[model samples]
Target chain A: MRYEEYNLEDLFLLAKKGDGTAFEHIVRQTEKQIYNLSLSIVKSNEDAEDLTQETYLRLWRSLPDYKGESAKSYIFRIARNLSIDLIRKRNRTPGSDTVILTADGEFERDIVDHDPDIRPDEAFIRRLTIETVRECISALPPPMRELIVMRDIDGLAYHEIASILEIPEGSVKSRLFRARERLRALIIEKNIL
Target chain B: MSKHSCKKYDFMIDDYIDGLLSDDDVRKLEAHLSTCEDCRQSLRFSIALRNMTRSAALEFPVGLHERIIESVNEDKKAKNVGSKRKIFRLGAISAACMLLCLCCTAVFLMLPGNRKSESKLPPDCPMSEAATDPSAMLPSFNGSVNAPEKGEDEGYTYPVIEEPALSSPEYDENSPEDAAPTPDETCAEPEEVAPNDKNDYEYSSTDAPANPAPDVMTNNSNISDRLENAADAEKSETHPVASPEGVPSARPGGEEITLALLIVSGLLAVASFIAFLISLSSIRTHSSNKENKK
Candidate 1:
């Protein structure tokens, strides 16, 4: 049977039994989200990629002991923890706190322009390009930035984010609301709206 | 250019943008929004921000999937090698322990005390034969020799005779009949004597005079001297031989050392066996996991 057809839990169980194909499928399924989460936290594509790889490596090693929970939450939790560890280690080093704007230029170039055929008012809502949003996200505190990335960018449920971050769902909702408001203020400061 | 003035409903804007608002709350917020343009602008900015953030999804870097798989395979190979090494190490330890145990057993068997205790003497051996015929160890005489006879109330009683001084004139070293036999001659048939028997007497006809001289038999001093000499010879033979430096023949603390070695080797053998078993089980588990993967 093709491993791609298996659900996340089935893939995890097969991977725990040392099924390489199932593990690869699981990796292929989650790498994009994990990379995005890492990028949102670390603000560097290179570091984010490294963090993503390390996350999966750790997941593979720990699969034997995985208690068959939500695979997406488990994988995201690993990615989140690895990203936090990288951030902490970077904090310990001198002159490493500076945010690299490498991805901002790429984001500006890659983002599509607002379509002129649409209504002017609707186009105004699409005026905040991907680069401006990323810059605003990069400017926020780490906690708020994480909430925006997990909730808005990744579209994870409040309960799933709570499970990943090991916090209460109510805390997730409140914090997420504050994060969105904070992002809105940043967008206004950029005069993108 | 509009400043947001409706601060009370600002919190509900997020819930509204996220579509989490109830129909009643939506109606209330919509009524408030129709009269207020600032809150309307705030709601529009929140919607724009959420949309832009969702548009910011990152593409997974190319070649990362292959790298991750390679690293995992490397880790699995390293773990398999490590388990094999563990099994080999445990097996080596078990073999070494068994060898040590065998060596300890050999050494234990070679110990003087163990040898004597564990071995059985032949029935025809003098030591075995003397158990049934204790009189065979006594000197033989044609005439009635004054043998110590066992009494009902008491043990054996010998004739009370005073020992003569060696410097006395009657005691003669030159007279063949009066001369005491050498210890070697008395101890020649050591098999006939029990090591623990206190009354061991040497009785070899070849070492004794063919006929006892009349003067030697008549002399009470000579008889007492001969009996004393026999008793001294028995005592020397029964006791362990001493070294020329006066040290005892058996090693000091040899038995204790051997016993300690045996106990230690036994414990080591048991520990190594347990280690071997654990490693074997782990290897089996690892192999079974590999099989399942295949």
Candidate 2:
């Protein structure tokens, strides 16, 4: 079955029961996201794979502990924990890739020039938007960086991000609000949005 | 539009981007944004940043799953093998220690003469006679002095005690040697007078010997006598005096050969056990660290 058909809890429960197929399907689904999260923190392809695998193994074992909550939030929680651990173990600074894209680099650089699925004109706009977005996100301090990641990249709701980050909803709102405002300025300055 | 005036909009910007505003909050925020061009610009920047971060995809390489599973399996196997090695090493060490004790006991036993033979010898005899014996000598010399006269005798005679090298030589031997004069040149004058007077003194005192070598001979005879005594004690199944001073010690003093065998075996066993333990611990610690990293 496609991993999309089953929620994270369903996949977790089945995998915990030693279902190799479910385990494989779950890995197939989440591996890319987990890998990306790990890569963002660790900044190494090999280490990212190792972190993703560890995340999956933990997900498999901890599936039985799922309490019928928001599957996306729960999975993101797991991913965040595993990614943080991997980064810490490697002793790498989070968002260390910030220097590669400077403030005005967004406007000067092409964005969707790297997109796997690209149309002719949309590619240029997508590329510019993406670069501006990446640059803007990179410029944020760690608190904002994490807030945006959970809310946008991982797609968790305000409550979900707050719970995962262990902050109040008000704080989440305030933090996200600042993060977005900063992004909008960067977009305007870069003229990509 | 002033930079100082933008502070009020700064705090609310993150919440606005996250869509956390209620209907009234949104209306108020929108109303503020509509009137404030600077706030509007700030809101747009926040939106762009969120969109960019969300869209960035961190890609994983191929075959990560199989590699991770393989690593875990290998680790578990290594741990299992390592534990068995540790157990084996521990067993070997205990066996070795016991064997070493046994061998030492046997070595002490097999030397039937021990200190009893020395007591039989003349008190004037320097302790270096054992090193001077021809059979115990090896061509690969360590520049050790074998002869010690009375003058040099104080520090030199018990070279075994002084040198440390002579006592526990690379080789082991137990044989008797000739008694020579002490290095004190002045003692040569007294030496001529002392032996004659010593014989008379011994005859008058011990009432056992009229001959010159009788004391030396008597000492050899006592070794056999002590051996016999040890045997009798063993026959009686009582603890025998192993020391020449008649201090009571471990039982079975006469069977040195048997004790030596036990000691060698015990020592070998102990060495193997210790090596095994070190190897196992190293492996375990290595694997445990690997597991932690994974």
Candidate number achieving the greatest TM-score relative to the actual structure: 1
lDDT of each prediction vs. the true structure?
0.67, 0.54
Candidate 1 ranges with C-alpha deviation above 4 Å: A1-6, A92-123, B1-8, B16-41, B116-252, B288-293
Q: Give the runs in model 2 whose Cα sits over 4 Å from its true position.
A: A1-4, A65-70, A94-129, A135-143, A178-193, B1-19, B59-294
Highest lDDT scorer:
1
**Interface RMSD (Å), each candidate?**
5.2, 8.7
Tell me the lDDT of model 2 at B67.
73
The per-residue C-alpha lDDT of model 1 at residue B109 equals: 85
Best by DockQ: 1
Candidate 1 local lDDT, A34-130, one digit each (tens): 8888887888889998998899889999998899898889999999988888878877331223323233211112222222122124455567688
* Candidate 2 chain B weakest ten by summed lDDT: B186-195
lDDT of 1 by residue, B1-294 (tens): 223345568778888887889999999999999997666766776777677788877667889888888888898899889888988888888888888888888988887655543213343444333323333333322223434455442533333222332223344445534332234333233322221222332434473454232232444434444444554454444433334576655665877787788888889888988988998897788678778767
lDDT minimum window of 10 residues, candidate 1 chain B: B189-198
